[model samples]
Target: MSTPDPDPDCPSTPTTTGTETYLSGGCHCGANTYQLTLPAQPSPPFPLVDFDHCTSCRRTSGALLQAWIILPQSWAVFHISSTFDQSHTVYASSVVTAGALRKELGGGEPKSLVHYASSPGVSRAFCARCGTHLVYSRVYEEREAGDGPEGEGDGEDFVGVSLASLDKDSLERAPRPLQHTWWGDGVPWLKEMIAKGCEEGGIGAMEKLEGYQ
Candidate 1:
């Protein structure tokens, strides 16, 4: 499904607050969309950004490296495209609070949104039709022994949004990777390549391509 031109009633522009900046993103097919409110500087560490290389993340995303921008559940709002015509016209859309979205995944509300446990207690949400991985989340009981991947279950009542799903402008404005997660699980060659890229003169000294000499 494709998102039609934004109806005045459904403005797609990003907004901001005194201390927060808003960014928007969605699935490739535009079946699902969300807004993320982040701090202008830094706060509760909610808007945490990091690169992940765990086996589960690699397998689930089919990518060598994955980046996640995490925040509190209350900091996001999701829009589900519900009504449309044969011409791919979006006639009606509904807003789903992050809490409600979490509770209704794979059940009701936001029919296009679905999720599955990539591992015990950890659910990954994606678009049913476009297959765009959107959110990662897990809940824990008080004093419960929550153990899994390096970055999973480290926080409470938080959801991690895939950096890959952010829109162009938002992605460009997203924060830099704060750290590397599950570094040991990364492929050896890929790790070497990344290390080289980080070295002072390594990237520029490597073979030049297309536009560069």
Candidate 2:
């Protein structure tokens, strides 16, 4: 069966927008740098934002909450460099698909980028030099309901970037996470804090320790 046409208004498709904005970011040690092209006011969540509470995400990131932004791989341009510095060159200039980008990077261009299989068919990328968690990806299989063939399924590759990896300006420009994922895997207190914070008005609901103000 053929794949369905992509939705033009979907947040995943940045090319549908009239105006474009670029967000530049990289790992802490600058080993991996990328620029994400987004719509001026990208849909509701052009760069789809969310908080991942999965145990794997928490353990890999070593953070209480792991924030991520999802987008099509075609929207991102990666900069590869032998030296992690301001001067880096773009390796793959053409638009790359989600699966293609993973393969290209996995070939070891920068030599600092490393990939780990967090679970079967689930991969996570990080900077070996800086130890900064960078990306999480998963392969999803969709089997159309029909009597075509046994175990026949189409695979979709998705990529999610670490929100904290974005530059200061990009982080400020990015939208706030709209939802929580893997809530069951989250710490109880952290979940309560989020619930209460939403119930009240923002961070004001949380306890402000000494020198916090």
Candidate 3:
């Protein structure tokens, strides 16, 4: 079957339980740093961290596997690392929804960011200096044909970032992922890694999808 058309305005249900906590994280060089405000208990339709095996994610990160921490833009907090000083460059998109709320973007790219336009409308931001994978995001371009942003994202989609960038405090608090995607393009080594994760006490037990483990 052909892939379905992507709904730019994917529905999003923001139900912060009022027990949210803050988690801090940065890159290996400390040049890229940010914070994530996560709910104490994860709401439905989203988990703390999810693994992606799509060819894009794998190729961009130079590995067979990559993971993303899903959090709404309203809930995901950005910060500035002292090391960047005053040279952080902003990588903004044509998406008008995020224009006014650019302040809420993850981390202050004061010193300029290395932005990779992974696809036509999808963008992946990373640290220009330390080369840290930051956010995997898509623009919800408001088109005249849509019905007031009622799709899966609801106009305020979560900024996808590397789960490894989240602080340990957040990691401990993160719930185990229950599902994954993009298996139509199967791989060999990743399956081995998944089986190893099951044996070595990683994110496993997600056998609902065959051939992943």
lDDT of 3 by residue, 11-123 (tens): 11222346966555655544445556566775545444667778998888876777777666665544333234323332322222222233333445344245677876567
Clash count of each predicted structure: 0, 0, 20
**All candidates in order of TM-score, best leading:** 1, 2, 3
Score each candidate by Cα lDDT.
0.74, 0.64, 0.55
91-190, model 1: which lDDT tens digit per residue? Answer: 6677876766767675644376788888766888887767888888766552245553334455556778898888777887778788888899998877
**Which has the higher lDDT value, candidate number 1 or candidate number 3?**
1
- Which candidate model has the greater lDDT, 2 or 3? 2
RMSD, model 2, all Cα superposed?
10.1
Ranking by lDDT: 1, 2, 3
lDDT of 2 by residue, 9-48 (tens): 1222222235886666777655566667776665433467
